[model samples]
Target: MESGTSSPQPPQSDLLDVFPQKGLEPGDIVVLVLYFLFVLAVGLWSTVKTKRDTVKGYFLAGGDMVWWPGLFSVLMLAWIFLPIYIAGQVDMYAGAIFIQQSLHLDLYLAIVGLLAITAVYTVAGGLAAVIYTDALQTLIMLIGALTLMGYSFAAVGGMEGLKEKYFLALASNRSENSSCGLPREDAFHIFRDPLTSDLPWPGVLFGMSIPSLWYWCTDQVIVQRTLAAKNLSHAKGGALMAAYLKVLPLFIMVFPGMVSRILFPDQVACADPEICRKICSNPSGCSDIAYPKLVLELLPTGLRGLMMAVMVAALMSSLTSIFNSASTIFTMDLWNHLRPRASEKELMIVGRVFVLLLVLVSILWIPVIQASQGGQLFIYIQSISSYLQPPVAVVFIMGCFWKRTNEKGAFWGLISGLLLGLVRLVLDFIYVEPRCDQPDERPVLVKSIHYLYFSMILSTVTLITVSTVSWFTEPPSKEMVSHLTWFTRHDPVVQKEQAPPAAPLSLALSQNGMPEASSSSRVQFEMVQENMSKTHSCDMTPKQSKVVKAILWLCGIQDKGKEELPARPEPVIVSLEENPLVKTLLDVNLIFCVSCAIFIWGYFA
Candidate 1:
């Protein structure tokens, strides 16, 4: 049965299935509530006290950080892709909880409630809050996942027992001929069959790398973290840390998932449509709930709650990041493009409001996500990304490295790539993937071609399109090439002479924040400013009440209180030079990290 769907004629067993016999106990509830309170407190406490009124301050957290951690690709993600991803996260979270706990509506409501709590802190505190909360969540996630990994290993008799039991963990009701419920032959391998495996070896090697590039280097969500870094060294250091951290999922998440099937094959590996639906409301499989099921069944009460918090932490971390980035892209890139004269205050408001819009849209898209990719969240994410994001990755690669790439070339390449991707996307949506025992009626393009392979094709086409178009178009000017391309990045900054304002002073001010006026216009502007000051004198200005001040504070608006706004600082150019010792240390760490990653892949292969 579809989740959240009710029957006109109720079955006699409806009441018995209304709630799970075992779920969060009193201790669990207390722990979960405490975690929620702590998260909210972190969000509230992390709000930056100064400079949030400015666009730079709010979205970028005042652009001052010792360590932490793009418009076209951002726009694509914000308007088209992010909502779907967010929906997937919601589905994953809800499914995790719902599969073992409560009714679908109650689970969805809880998810939305969590979203609201997340938005409260994220919108009010901006990126600073996100960073701070993310730190806390990361800790919680690590602790919980590591604890679960230990338990899972112990329960399964370690790696040797896991490998032996995984193949034996089969659903009794699964069809023998279909290979529907059987454990994968290549489950232990990272590099699998080039043609037959779900994640083909060639596609995983080449195809996955494109989206990784877009995500790591170009996508707003990831790039924003690095942008907040104090300097290039900090950014590189953060990247190094993240590279090492990425390898943890294989042991913590993937192996634990396998352990779940080994422990409870009847539910986690259930392949019969009716049995699967009864277990998790996804007829395709219940593998998505493996982690949560393990958490609930294996962990004790307080720990189960901690594990729930971990699940929630993971969800909120992702949601908050996406929310902030989407808001930033919409407010700074899209809305600002449409309303060039929009004030910083207006932009801030729009950014916060856009978060709400995202929440609504993502909620509406949940049903679609539930039905897609055999109800597998990971597959849905990877498949959709493969369809749409390879073009963006290719475009970013060319723009950064190739001096010939002009706006026109990039524009046409994006359009062509998007059109092709959309064709495939639409076809996939229209003709959903069939079950293992069912006839595969999906178009041969989708059935025969894996998403990873499609991503490779999409990226190649985009690369060719961009190169050809750029070659045919007028070459970019020196000004455009300077300080923009990879080759020209180290060139010294050159200031150009300011020209007399061709547009009106207001228009000029709107465009560049500082007005560039001719002598006559300068005098006129001064006179107008003087008149405005006289008209809005201190005696005539209304006093803000205490309540108003509190409201503004909650909204993250700084109260200037008769103080003059400071001049905006010029953009800082971070020196790339790192101390030799630090550089050597980082280099060694990089080598170690890469070697470890390769060793794992080879071992698994």
Candidate 2:
């Protein structure tokens, strides 16, 4: 592990470790974290007095949210998906350069630039600012990723050419003793069997996707944005919108790896003995440098930076969100609970302290992260999250919808899942070991496809099994059941009898003016006259009268011989135009998004 002047240059070997780049210095990491803290402080400072009055104000920004800010939050949160995808690209691209020394510098620069922009906006406006910036950033990322794909496809001479080239590469690898090869199926072959294969189909389909769902759906960092929505409809709509965006990445991230293989067939060969020895001596030195190298060497300059920025933006988006959410959870969930009646000023101060502590912890952890080797960042994060998420999801879901799920069940289930997950992780570590000769050789824990699936299964089974067993042994309190049933049950339906005809305008006025009529009014309009005839408590209408009665009934009111419904009273409306703060936020976000889009596009271009 040579240091200082002895450090090798980029593209010298695909295995060159990126930690030695010195770009993201300890100070830089600290600065990044501090930037987040500052942003949070500013946000808190603006709302401290308001937030002190209610939990909702602190947690949800008072919820009278506008469309632009809400949209921004959704977009910023959605940006998380980019980093999770790009981390894999970095791994793959670095791997591609291992064969040929055609790695590029623009790609890394692009990533760095994107991170800078994200940090700036996040620092400028807190969550609100970050969200608006993210919406535009997300669009750029999608465009940049897709553009790369299109160019790569055309470079390889289309899908048919890609397949032909792949097969030819595979055939050549077989003859010359190479590790690269084409699969038996076409491009769309998604389901690979885990039992007899290197990559498992079932593992990805069931195991990986489930953890993803849990992460994207239940994880606090992601879900916090949805919670911030003004209403449930907005929250649901925002989430679904992000879900649709999720389906676009397969083509963007994975296809580039395949394209790299086709274009640089020779690099796909086994690592040269010399490079392999260097890598073995310091595995962390070059393990994740592959994808960045490919991007720098291959893409045109302007487009290169755009793609790199997209990747960097992705990373920053996740880091900032995690930092903010972690601070939030620590302050609201832990600190506030301990000091239940803490003052607004005190809580804000406590939140800042927690932010500083978390940042420091993360900084300390970064070195440990750099020291470790193997596994893609995305996979590593997801696998670890899988172990932690299931039980939390179970408890939260049950607590929200099922009142019968007592605090005891919630506590025990969470504990059971955590313990089970930890035990499974330990067991898996002990059982699985690589058979390579080198001292540093270890099984690829993060890259293992089923890791998330395995952790999630263990966590889920333990939680449900423990919770269910506890449920029957100590039945839920009767009060709990009553509360649960109250929320869950449907209201009873009742029938009503028809009355004789009245004046048209009178009937219309009655229907319109009595808009706040009791539940019985709805029932009265629905019951048919013929059905009422059986009781003989009300008079039956003639055949033509029945037709008129049916028409009135459908409108949820008696016709009363009305030709038209009367106009209802004018509804009261509130104006927010006089609110200077609201106007400022609107102006800021609009300018912010526009400026960000221009800068990102221009810088990338």
Highest-scoring model, TM-score:
1
| Tens-place lDDT digits, model 2, residues 255-372 | 6666655554333322343333343223222324334434554666556655555554465556556545555576777788998655443555455455445444543444333333
Model 1 ranges off by over 4 Å: 1-21, 48-50, 68-105, 176-178, 498-548, 559-568
Quote the lDDT for 473 in model 2. 64
Q: In model 1, what is the error at residue 193, expressed in angstroms? A: 1.1
lDDT of 1: 0.74
Superposed by TM-score, candidate 2 places the C-alpha of residue 478 at a distance from the truth, in angstroms, of 6.7
Clashing pairs in 1: none
lDDT (Cα, 0-100) at 266 in candidate 2:
34
For model 1 the local lDDT of residue 562 reads: 25
**Best lDDT among the predictions, by candidate number:** 1
Instruction: Give the alpha carbon lDDT tens digit for every residue of 1-605 in model 1.
Output: 45564422111222113223358778987988899999999888877553466778778877775453211111111122232354335544554354236223465676677778888988888887787788788889889999999999998789988887788787666677787887888898889999989899999999999887777667777777777666666666777767777888998999998988887777777778877788777888777777777787788878988888888888788788888888988888789999987866678889999988887777776666777757577888888888888998888878878999988888988888889989999998898888777898877898999999999999989988999999999989988888677788787778666655433444434433456667677647645655565545565445777888776776676644222433544656657678899889878988998899889988988
